[model samples]
Target chain A: MSDDLIGADGRKLTFDANQIRDLLPHRWPMLFVDRAYDVIPGKSGYGIKNVTVSEPYFAGHYPDQSIMPGVLIVEAMAQLTAVVYASAWKEEVADSDEVDTAGRVGYLGAIRQMKFNRLVVPGDQLILKAELGKAFGTLTPVTVQASVGNELVAKGSLTVTERGSGGGNGLQ
Target chain B: MSQSYDELLDQAQARASLNLRVKVLLVDSLGLEIQAELIGDDQPLFGRGLELDSLDTLEIVVMFEEHLSVTISDDDRAAFGSVNKLVDFVVAALGEIPRVEALA
Candidate 1:
């Protein structure tokens, strides 16, 4: 709630996990975004996911070596897109409480030109970014990229279908 | 008479080359199992023809932007009906590539 976290447009630029929970329906284990900042409403946004050894996937993904899965990295980027779109929706419906913007869901329709350049490991803070591309009817395409510090991890374009009244809360 | 015939032949070759390029783009980029030459110009690209889905269409959109330097909007979905239609769409979007450059 710091003034620094608010953009000049009066939109929240940073969101903690508790605030993210209100915009996204994802619970523990599935929710990949830990903290999001530099959010520009629906246009673009940035997020962070701190990969750690305590993650359940690391338990069996290789006890000796823990490499964060590439798909999960992409998922993190998608979640950031969700936050961007949901935040935009919340602004549009600020006066209405009957419509729950938090429940708005976006389903992954297609992943195009995805490439993984590096392996993400435990202790790495995955930085996720998404830019809204074009809207093809209900499907909104987003250009996404993820990196750990300066090392690029994954890049792709994902088309998410906005379902339900506010956009569904599941990835299909 | 022979001069006009040669011009017609040149036009035919240019069209054929454009069609071949479109087919190759679709097969190579989408990893379609069929041979590029086998994809008929008039054959449907979706459903019963090449069985292309929405994802394939999106990939094709990217392909058009990257390779052909042409942008295909959502309104242009009908242009993706077949190899011939796609060639026409690309040609139109590109404002007619010279016959020599197209064949080359």
Candidate 2:
């Protein structure tokens, strides 16, 4: 078995918005990760979410002060997780005749020890990161962090069900 | 050196309390509807017994790490078979069943 945590072949994987759309089930207002890079397949990756003034939530989240909701930051981290796992699945099926790794979504199993450091406002570029841990059956624990520039926005660990596990409780 | 009756009784009490704590964490962390006291020591944690799916396994793993300071890796998953099995793993890892009062 290969002992490398980061696969050499998958390290070069990157995703733009259109490529991310092909991998994730999220769309429109729900899609948080605008771009992804430094991907090591199922191991770890980084993503970017360009927080803009035109975001729908800013209309009411406080018309006066537009701070990005902390939950959305968590959701963005989850989406980046999907990219990591989905990209890994794609690598597994690369040589196969039927390569259908599109729209594979991972369900959030549990979020733990999340801490929001500072407020995320409009015109901020949210940098998201996730690193995979040992799997507990189909549940894989991911350590995630979201930041704007050099300032940390949120940091935590969360568990997500593996892709195609079908562990969804009819929420899909 | 042989052992006193009181010492043995205290150890037994600690083990019993540990079993209940494991059960309580399983229920609380997994968001199970049943009460902890209702769970039998020998009852299976997955499948037909507790009906816990794969998603709940990670919560139990984290619970052990955060509360008991025991790291249950995938290789040690046999500990997840039952409540008693989990407590036994913890006791084995810790080298003793720490008394509830002592833990406090």
In angstroms, the error of model 2 at B53 is 5.8
Candidate 2 iRMSD in angstroms? 5.2
In terms of TM-score, how similar is model 2 to the real structure? 0.73
- Across residues A11-64, which tens digit of lDDT does each residue of candidate 2 receive? 657788998887888998999999888888889888999999999999988889
Q: lDDT values of the candidates? A: 0.81, 0.82
lDDT of 1 by residue, A1-172 (tens): 2436787677658888998998888888999999888898888989999998899988877788898888888788889999998888877887876556555666787776699999988889988999987665556778999988888889988887676664443322
Q: Candidate 2: where are CA atoms >4 Å away? A: A1-12, A163-172, B1-40, B43-54, B65-78, B89-102
Clash count, predicted structure 2: 0
* Model 1 error, position A113 (Å): 3.6
Candidate 2, residues B1-104, lDDT tens digits: the string is 67899988888888888888887778777788998889999999888999986667777887888899988987887988999899889999989885554322
